[model samples]
Structures are given as structure tokens and as C-alpha cells.
Target: MARRTHKGEDDGTTSNNRLELIIEAAARMFDAKGYSATSTQDIANEVGLLKGSIYYYINSKEDLLFRIIEESHEGALRAIATVSHLDVGPLAKSYALVTTHVKVFHDDRVKHSVFFKEFRSLSDNRKEIIRGTGHAYSLFLRSILEEGQQVGQVDKALNPRMATAGIVGMLNSMSFWYQDGGSWGPENIGSQFAEQVVLGLVSEEYLLSSGGRKVLLETIRGELA
Candidate 1:
């Protein structure tokens, strides 16, 4: 059975909203102060609720940390899921995924920091869950790479596993330096980042080859089919 959190409210009212607020506040606090240094009361205070009120939503500070990490993962997965279902080929899918990945992180600075940095605060079991989610997302990217290779748009010599890891590492590193205070918007940053990723992964020759086109189409069809 699927586990539901504190409130029975399915409409995202009452308990769900409170939980969202709690998670958001926790993400901010975790980003500002390292997760170990931040307390449940700090999170509760950020949300303008009593510290005891937080227990009604989560069991401990670690749970709140887990929730923040999970939110970013869910956002990332949703972005990938959307691109994975697109009618476009592997190249486009790659572009869309990169674009979404950059935009989501750049747009949600606090969650972005927690996703890349504060995940370590989770308990071993919770850390495993985050690892599983991270692995699944990497596999999803690799699947796209595999499709690209098989269809001929991507280099068959390209190792999807390493390449996927590299791409994620590159993108995630931006959190360390990306300035939300800058004049650049998320769209501009995302597009620029996506272009770099796409350029690195897709060769001009591959884009022109019949094999490349075939592989690209097949990759999308295989994923969506």
C-alpha cells in the first residue's frame, strides 16, 4: 500500500499544503545552514508553526530533510517524464531533458541546493531511497542515450552510463556557482546549459547521417512505445 503522510486530505488542502510549506522552509534552512546544524524547530519557526506541530507531518528532522530531497527528485523526474513522452527524437529528448533539468534547478534555488548538497543529512535508509531515485533518473537518461546510439544519432562508442553521470555532474555543479541574484533568467541559463550539453553529446555528422536520423526516431519510438 502507498504510504500517505500525516493528513488524509487528498486535495492538497490542509495537511498537504502545510507539508509543502514545511518542506520549502526546510529546504531554505538546510541550504543556508548545513543540514546537521539546522533543527526541526528552525524549520517549524520558518513555517510559523510550533515545533510540535511539525511532528504531526513528519517523524523527525531527518524526515523533513528526506522530504526536501524527495521534492527535488520528484521535480526532476516529472521533467524527465514529460520529455520522455515527447514525439521528438533522441536529440530533442536530450535537449528537453537538459533544458528542464537546468531550468528546474535554477528556478527553485533552495530545492536545488538541497538536492545537490543537503541530501547527506538523510538517514541511511532515506539516503538509499534518494540513491535509488537518483539511479533511476540516470537510467532514464542512459535509456535515451542507448536509443540515440541504436538509432544512430549518438555515438555507439559513447558509454551511456559515464556520459549520463558526467552530464548530471556538470549540471549539478552549477548550483555551487549559479547566482539567483543575477539578471539572467532561468530560461536563458537553461537554454545555454542545454546547448552545451547537446553540443557535447550530439555531433554534427551524427545529425546529418541517415543512421543518425533512424536511431533518433527509433529511440523516441522505443521509449514512448
Candidate 2:
């Protein structure tokens, strides 16, 4: 694909750094204000760049939006990729996935908030690309649920696809009510949410050891850590 940068644009770290700065500022503004309502000038002002400088890197506002959404998904996918091959039971893998998902969700709330809410603003081609990323998430989580069922770790009666949707819905909803600097940090929230997910899946065997699941969780988490 052709480069978006202008022909005479400097191929230096400074240009790259400025592009990063613009994207970061744009994410914040787009989250605060709808993408349709934000302009390149507003982004430039937010980044302390001249209005023309935005054109130096991006061809249009949607270009910036596309970059932000893709970047957030890329960050999350990379993080979760580490958990895919963990030599642990499906239940523990599910727990780790939830925590990792939530952590990545909030690692930059501004950026990811735009990701979860504003993806529809992209062009159809770009929208398909974003949807592909989303489908990967569904496959990853659904596979874990399916594996757990097969191994008797999760309830065999549960529908893996529906279970995947329920868990993902609950985690995504956190973005709506979650506040920065809340009583709990990402790790704590992730653990609590992950525990709920694990507990919901185990009704008989896991409950016998008792609801604490603390010992089990600690062992799994320690290995993961």
C-alpha cells in the first residue's frame, strides 16, 4: 500500500514520534467527543501541532481513527497470544484470558473505549478488518470454553458459544461503569471477575473443595505469573 505520509515528509524518529502523539491525543478526543464531531484541527490543537501537520501523517480523520482502533486490538491480541499455548487446564486458561482481556481493555481506557464504541465509524473495508480481529477473540474464548467442557472442567451442559458471549458481554460491560483510580486496580478487578467466571462454570467438583477456589486460583496464577 502507498504511504499515507506526504512525499516530502521526513523519514525520521521525530516524524514517527509526532504521529504517535497525534494518535494518542485523537483517541482521547474521540472518546470524549464523537468521532463524527471531531476535526483534524481539533486533534492538532490537542497535540500542539499545526493543523497541516496532521495531513503530514494521515490522509484523513478516519485514517487516524482506523489506526487507533487497530492499534488497541493489536496490543490486546499480542498480550492474549501469550496465553494460547499455556500448559495448563482449560479452566485456568479461561481465568487468565479474562484477566488479560480486562487488563488490556483498561491499559489505555481512552484508546480502547473508542475501540469498543466507535468502530462503526470506519469505512466498510476497515470495518471488516476490525470485525476479523473481533472474530479472533470470539474463537479464542469459545475454544477455551469448548476445551473445558470436553475435559469436564467446565459444565458440559453449558453452550460454549453462548457461554463465550455471556463472559465477553460481562467483561465488556465493565468499560461502561468502570472508573479510573477506583478502589481496585486492573489486576484485582481482573482476578475478581475471573473468579466469577470460573465459579459459574464449576457447580459440583470445584464447589466441593469449597467456593474459596483460592488455593486452586493461587496455584494456577502463580504458574501463570
Candidate 3:
């Protein structure tokens, strides 16, 4: 059980700002020192609050963690929602999905990092809630892959369900290894990832058409504006 430090006290901060502070602080603490290792006092101290002040904004640390995970998916889901409205082909649409995910994963990376590492800690009840959101995201990817299969762009033999799992597993695993800075930005990293997955998914005929593949990738992989 998590230790109770003290009773909550009023700090006179506005309700909204104080809550935001707690959420952001908790994400950082979770990122820096795994969730199980982090404490209410750690978050309170980070926010310059009394030990119990955190409880004023949230019932428990796990609730805060759940909130973070939910927010982490919000941006990406919204981005993916936009993909359906695009005029692009399956391959370009695939690139958009991958690139949007890359940018979202990196944009609020701390929350995402905590999301990947700490998701298992959620109670089964809460896990079910989060799993709903996860399923929606997975379905988006699967639909695009299935569309590619229909168009003969993706290999007819490919299994969209299994491929979605593999791709999501690969992308989520990056949370453990990808660093904030290096030669690559989200665009480069996302592009390279898209290139690899798209290549593997391409049908033999599609892969053989050098001009077709080259032209499409160059067009879709540009700034997503």
C-alpha cells in the first residue's frame, strides 16, 4: 500500500492550475523514478505542496497515472481521425498514421514513457477502461492495412490483425529505447519506420513499380500540413 504522509491542506491555488501541476509533476516523477517507486510526497514536494495536497486534486496516484495515459492517447487519436478524411492512397495514408503516431509519441514523451512502462500497474477495472481506447487506436491501423490489401498495394497474404499487433508492439517499444536528442527528429524516425513497414507490406507488383512507389512516398511523407 502507498504510505499516507499527512492530511490534505488548502494551498489557495486555483483549482485548474493546481490539478495541471499535479498531473505534469506526477508524469515527470513516474518518468524519472518508476511509478511504484514514486510517492505522493514526491509529487507534493515537486509541486511545493503539503504531502496530502495531492489528494485534494486527485484521489490517488493511480488515478493521476490513468489521466496521463488517457491524455497521451488523445492527441494521436485525433490525428488518426483526420487520416480518414484525407484524399491519399492506402500507402500514403499508412505513412500519415505512422508519422502522426511518431510525432504524438515524441511530443509529450514523458507522459508516453510513463504510459508504456507503467500501464500494467493499473487495476483491472481501470485497465479495461484504457484498453477500450487502445482498441480504437489499433482498429484505425488495421483498417488502413486492410484497405491496402484490397487495393493490391499491400501483400494479399498479410494479416491486418496480426500486423497491427506487431506494428503497435514495435512502435510502443520505442518508449524504452528512443532518446530525446540525436541526429533524428520525429519526422526522420517516423519516416524510416513507415518506409520499413510499408516496404514489407507492399505487394510484389506494387514493389516492382519503381516510379509509383517513389512518387507516392515522396508526396505523402512531406510535412503533414
Candidate 4:
């Protein structure tokens, strides 16, 4: 039996599936055209539904934007959770973080693009909600760097907060230039980025030490595996 959504629509579409389609369509339109330039009618045209029908899935266009940003943030949190459980050192964990971060952007370019590009378009309340999630993700990265420093793998002198922000900024920038069929695939770009971020943060002594080499190789293998 087809379940009807709260909107009372009986198109034989599940509510979750319908909502996903609406959100995806909105993300695509918002990514290509600026949020301010994108209208409800535009989303409707992309989704092949009437403008009024969109309201059945969301309260307003702003709501759709908020959902997209929230979804991306949720994905980041999930990635952080996955990396946190790995039975590896901070360097390996950091490598996993970078790989996961870049892959998310590559996998969902439109959502992440809308997330990075149109975040400010959300209302104050929605902005606060998204900001909280962003801060949590930031703290997670900072914690990873701090753990690395404590273990003598990362530079003790480096500020974890600043390093975290820098790494995140570098990975997030991919949404601006990364194309679907780019010469460098997501794994290659992610692996190279992991090298840059992980090696840059580790101390010279650690890099030269046997333990450091083992850790580095293990981290690389974990990323490849």
C-alpha cells in the first residue's frame, strides 16, 4: 500500500523519497544559480513538479537551503564518528579524515556546493543550527590534531585550532574547482591532500624516526585500504 505523507499527496511516492528528490533538485539549482536568484518556480521546474507542490515537502525555499546545509553537516559528523573508532594513531586518523572529507564533497558535489556557497542565505535560526553543527565538526578535527601532538606525531608547537581550520579549509575548497570527470579522481586528490596535511603537521624528528616511517606507511595503507 502507498503511504500518504502529511501533505496528503497520494502519488505513490514514499515521503522520504519525495523529500530527497526535492532536496536534491534544490541543491542542484542552488549550486548552479545563486540562492537569491533561484526561485520556488525554478526548483519546481527542475523537479518537474508545480511550484505549489514543493510547499507540500518544505515550508519555504529557505527551508530547503537549510535542509541541504544540515544534511552535509550531518554527513561530516558521521565521517568524524567513523574516523574516531579506527584503531590507529592520530596521523592515520587524520589521513582517514582528509580522505573521507574530500570523498564526501566529490560524492555529493551539489549538496556540498550549496552547503559552502549558500549557507548565509539561511535564516538566523537556521544559521544558528548549522553553525552549531559546523563548530562540532571543527572541534572534532582539532581534537584529532591535539591527540597527534600529545603522541609526539604532530608538531607540538603547532596550534591545533589553527591547523584544524587550515586542513578543513583546504579540503572544502575542492567544491569550487572539482568536476565530476576531472583528471584527478577523488581518491587521488584525497591521498595527495592527506600527505600534504599529515606530513606538514608531523615533526621532522618523527618523520625521520623508524616509528614515524612505520606510522606513515600504515596511515597510507589504511587510506588505500
lDDT (10s digit) by residue, model 3, range 173-201: 87888888967788899988888788778
Point out the worst 10-residue segment of candidate 1 by lDDT: 4-13
How much is 67 displaced in model 4, in angstroms? 0.8
TM-score for each prediction? Answer: 0.81, 0.89, 0.88, 0.89
lDDT of each: 0.76, 0.83, 0.83, 0.83
Q: Find the 10 residues in a row with the least total lDDT in model 2.
A: 2-11
Question: Residue pairs in steric clash, candidate 3?
Answer: none
User: What would you estimate as the lDDT of candidate 2?
Assistant: 0.83
Candidate 2 C-alpha lDDT tens digits along 1-225 = 855655435566588887888899899889989898899999988877678766888999999999999998886687569778788888889888888888888887787889878888999999999889878988988888888887777888888899889998998787687889999889899999998998888646655654457776776677787
Global local distance difference test of model 1: 0.76
Task: Order the numbered candidates by lDDT, best leading.
Answer: 4, 3, 2, 1
Better of 1 and 2 by lDDT: 2
Question: Candidate 4, 223: how far from true, in Å?
Answer: 8.2
lDDT of 3 at 74: 88
Clash numbers, per candidate = 3, 0, 0, 0
Considering lDDT, which of the candidate structures 1 and 4 is the better prediction for this target?
A: 4
